[model samples]
Target: MRRPAFHTRLRAHASACGGSSLIEVMLAVALVAVSALGLIAAQVWTAREARAMSLRESATWIADSIAEATRTPSVGNAALNQWSAWASVLLPHGDASVGESGAVAAARVTWASVRDRPTAGDGIGPSAEPCGGVDAPAGSSCVALAFAQ
Candidate 1:
């Protein structure tokens, strides 16, 4: 048989190595899968954060409304009870409490916060701490407001 040219042999060898091996293909797929998972986790975290923020805003609005109502004369228990009931409906695991001593009146609205999510620092329940304050019960978030007549 006649000998093949050196260039032809090199071309054949190059063609043989051109395609990815099974292991390489698997590794590439695995890498892409990992990246996709990370993206999904980030999106979930973002959504959770957004929901938490919305809850916080609602709590603030409720607290403010209660405080404003307290400023009016003869703000009856029925009205306050209605406000609390409305807040409970508007937020998850929501509760509202109002207290009055002398000329000062305070209202607090507490709701369920996402547990096991770190905020600012890695301290346990840090995410709930700001909203819940020291009075936040375990596994709950809170917002409090006060008004003086």
Candidate 2:
């Protein structure tokens, strides 16, 4: 028997390997799609965490400002009201308060997190109050600082 021609052998090999290329292409697409989805999820999570951190930083600043104002006897109710108004402008559903007990004074700033409204707390972390021992309001986060007079 005569062996097949080189061209014929090549044709047979190509036909046999054709389906594998299609399968390989499909698998490659699938892998790329899965990787893209994972990256998109990571981007979303990063954006959410960034927003949360920004809100936390704003709350801290407001709390610190209130604490500083409390140190001055000349800064009275008007100044406190202004700070509270500022907080409301800086954060969603924001509020600020100052409390004094004995020789210690505390400043607290609270705001509702847009992503945590339905859950009633910071959903990303352990379910704990942000304002030290005090429980923050439902759906809200807080920053509190205490100083001795």
What TM-score, computed on C-alpha atoms, does each candidate reach?
0.73, 0.83
TM-score of 2: 0.83
lDDT of each residue in 1-149, candidate 2, tens digit only = 77669978899999989689889999999999999999999999899999989988998898888888878778846777988999999999899888778888788888987653346253655555657447786667788889876
Model 1 regions lying over 4 Å from their true place: 1-11, 15-21, 117-134
Q: Determine the backbone clash count of candidate 1.
A: 0
Clashing pairs in 1: none
Q: Give one digit per residue, the lDDT tens place, for model 1 in 53-87.
A: 99999999988888877677688566678788988
Error of 2 at 54 (Å): 1.0
Q: Any idea what lDDT model 1 has?
A: 0.78
Cα TM-score of candidate 1: 0.73
Best by lDDT: 2
